[model samples]
Target: MKNARPLPSYLVQRYHGWKATTHAENKAWYRRLAEEGQRPRAMIISCCDSRIHVTSIFGADEGEFFIHRNIAGLVPPYAPDGDHHGTSAALEYAVTVLKVANLLVVGHSNCGGIRGCHDMCAGLAPQLEEKTSFIGRWMDLLRPSYERQAGIADETERLRAMEKEAVLVSIENLMTFPFVQAAVESESLTLHGLWNDIGEGVVECYDPDSARFLPV
Candidate 1:
């Protein structure tokens, strides 16, 4: 990060203002969180996109929700054999140690990762077709979704469907963890899925029984 530029002055000034106002007002709450440690009620795995604001959407407070973000908010199928698994590690800690009651996978429309997967698989992104491309390798996680949506005729609908598919796939992948499965069986934990329409500023929650997303 040595080459990283300094943060803009405006952002720093805003932070100072928040410190004097928001932080000052909630000093005791912050202290309590630091002292007693966080016991979040849910773990939200979401996209790394700037448009997807997890805490803002849910109106979550500090230490209220354990959040992990990745490209397209994907959860790769349970592979305990991998050498480096950042998302899996975070999930393990959240489920087993944190004992969060709810695990949520939130995906959004217009995801670059999902689009990249569509392009790379369709031979649109020649650069991403390279085996060594990290983004390409990461985007492979969503390939199953692409295959599933192969019947969709409209390009826009396909993209939207893929976005939702990412959420559904993540929900399935969460079960691949032994602890997660055990928790779900014991009724100690529940899984939820959400898809966001960034332009519309609308969110839809996935209903397992209905197999559809209802407005939230």
Candidate 2:
């Protein structure tokens, strides 16, 4: 592309460092993964937050999880409307092709996308309310979540709840896929919702029994 540029110096150095050490150490395992293809046990849909390291958090290997990152980790409802659906495409491939046994929608603390949705819904962000804003349109998926948490009076509490609600919304939307429903009904696939408190270094899992997020 015309605007394309070489990798930054620090990134390049890091890549070389990783290639010489970690990649070298895991050469055989990497080779095996390449030859056999990936058979990930789970598919994780998470936010594009730099701090929330999914693999590091779980101590997962490269081939163990199929991860898709997007703003606020939001998942839209099953819409086969022929528009460009990156998240849905990834989900379909994970469920139908990879046959991942578990699908996790992970949300995290102080999510900018979630905050934007909160502000936009409250009529505080005019830019996000604009028709041409991609983030705005994408975050519309979480509008229901904002509305659901309107009863909360405190700003911090309401935003925190909205963050968790994003995970719920994604999980609920994931089930809308026909293949996902089939796999789940047959007990082949299980769904999970998770909220990670980045600063606190705590991960909470959604407990269906109590309908609450309990620490993992």
Candidate 3:
């Protein structure tokens, strides 16, 4: 523990400022949230892109959402083989424990993780193919989606298609969990897919009826 690092001064200062301002202003609400515990109605699985601010975009309150962010916001195929599965574990907790009414797999435009997966599959990023590469292995979950979009001829359109596919793929994989499947079947849970364009400030929701992403 000797080499453990302390938080940066600016971040610490910001925390202090928030503690004195936002925290003080919303003291009762914060205290109630702490004492009563969180009961978020929605669970959001989103990319860990700094530009994609899920909370800010949705104007969600502190305890309104149970959010999980990873490289591509991916959900691996359910395998109860007693292995470490962080994303799947979180998904299980959300669907079973939290019992969120809505589960959203939110993908965003210009995802570096998706691009990396595309490049790796195309033999452009050799580093990602290494067995020791964590990102590479994690992105393997998204490789199927990349292959699904292989028919697209234009690079830009294909990239966009793959970005949207990330959400679609996660939704498909999420259903592999028995609890999630049960919840949806009983109308206890509703699954949603969303893709955001950060630059254009546009959001699209996947319509299962039309089988296309429509502006929302």
Q: How many residue pairs clash in each candidate?
A: 0, 0, 0
After the best TM-score superposition of candidate 2, give how far the Cα of residue 165 lies from its true spot, in angstroms: 1.2
Which wins on lDDT, candidate 1 or candidate 3?
Answer: 1
Find the candidate with the highest lDDT and give its number. 2
The regions of model 3 sitting more than 4 angstroms off are none
Q: Order of candidates by TM-score, top first? A: 2, 3, 1
Tens digits of per-residue lDDT for model 1 on 67-154? 9999988888889785899999999999999999999999998999999999887789999978889899998888878888978999
Compared to the true structure, candidate 3 yields what TM-score? Answer: 0.97
Q: Estimate each model's TM-score.
A: 0.95, 0.98, 0.97
Candidate 1 has which clashing residue pairs, if any?
A: none
Ten contiguous residues minimizing lDDT sum, candidate 3: 141-150
> What is the per-residue lDDT of model 3 for residues 84-133, given as tens digits with 9 covering 90 to 100?
98888888888888899999999989999989999999899999999999
